[model samples]
Target: MDHPLLLAFGLLLVVEGLFPLLAPQAWKDTFSRLIGLRDGQLRTIGLIGVALGVALLVSFS
Candidate 1:
């Protein structure tokens, strides 16, 4: 339902904002390090994230 979807998005925003809100310097440092990663490395990380998300959705559904 729309309610559940909205709650999911809200929770996602909260979780995504935690690092920057609680440890801004650390978050910036992480971004700086990420900037040095190769495109292939970034792609691999993204693929893993997508795969994990899909696996979680499948298990939950």
Candidate 2:
């Protein structure tokens, strides 16, 4: 796998995961629901995010 996208996704996961950790009660319930999603759902969402990011980069190029 080309690593830049994977690195970006890893960074995204850390930042996204931090939101709930930092805010605690405010975002806890919302994140908890997302945490329960089936594996496929999460993967789809992650792929969408990566695709969108790539689209943005390509557009600028």
List model 2 lDDT by residue over 1-61, tens digit each: 6798798789889998897779878797877899899999999999999999889989987
**Which stretches of model 1 miss by more than 4 angstroms?**
none
Candidate 2 off by > 4 Å:
1-24
Check candidate 1 and list the clashing pairs. Answer: none
Q: Which lDDT tens digits does candidate 1 get at residues 4-57? A: 779988988999999999999999999999999999999999999999988988
* Candidate 1 structure lDDT: 0.95
Span of ten consecutive residues with least summed lDDT in model 2: 23-32
Clashes of 2: 0
For lDDT, the strongest prediction is 1
lDDT of each: 0.95, 0.88
